[model samples]
Target: MGQVLFYKDLWKEEFWENPWELGGLIVIGLFTVTFLFFILFAVLFGLLFPSEQTENEE
Candidate 1:
């Protein structure tokens, strides 16, 4: 007999029975993590180096 694959819940549980779905999940997860880090660093940089407004002096 052949083995049957199924889509498992990643949030509630661990391990993926299907390779195709697991690959998709991994790719999406990586992209999500990258975006999260990018946003975090952007906010930190903005706060640390805020632009200043100045008027012309005589």
Candidate 2:
């Protein structure tokens, strides 16, 4: 338990101080947002304009 707390504290103090960590975090955030936006746009587009289907075509 003590080691876990120490590591947690160390991470809190060190993680943000590293440039690579910050850059990696930023890249990850951007990718996540882009992916989410794509999914949202696709869903909205599908909802707004659904494809026409005929039962006999199947």
Clashing pairs in 1: none
How large is the C-alpha RMSD of every model relative to the true structure? 7.3, 3.0
Candidate 2 lDDT by residue in tens digits, 19-42:
999999999999999999999999
User: Least lDDT summed over 10 consecutive residues: which range in candidate 1?
Assistant: 1-10
Candidate that would win on TM-score? 2
lDDT tens readout by residue for model 1, 1-58:
1222333344334546667779999999999999999999999999999978768633
**Pick by lDDT: which candidate is best?**
2
lDDT of each: 0.77, 0.97
- Compute each candidate's TM-score over C-alphas: 0.60, 0.70
Candidate 2: where is the Cα deviation over 4 Å? Answer: 1-7, 53-58
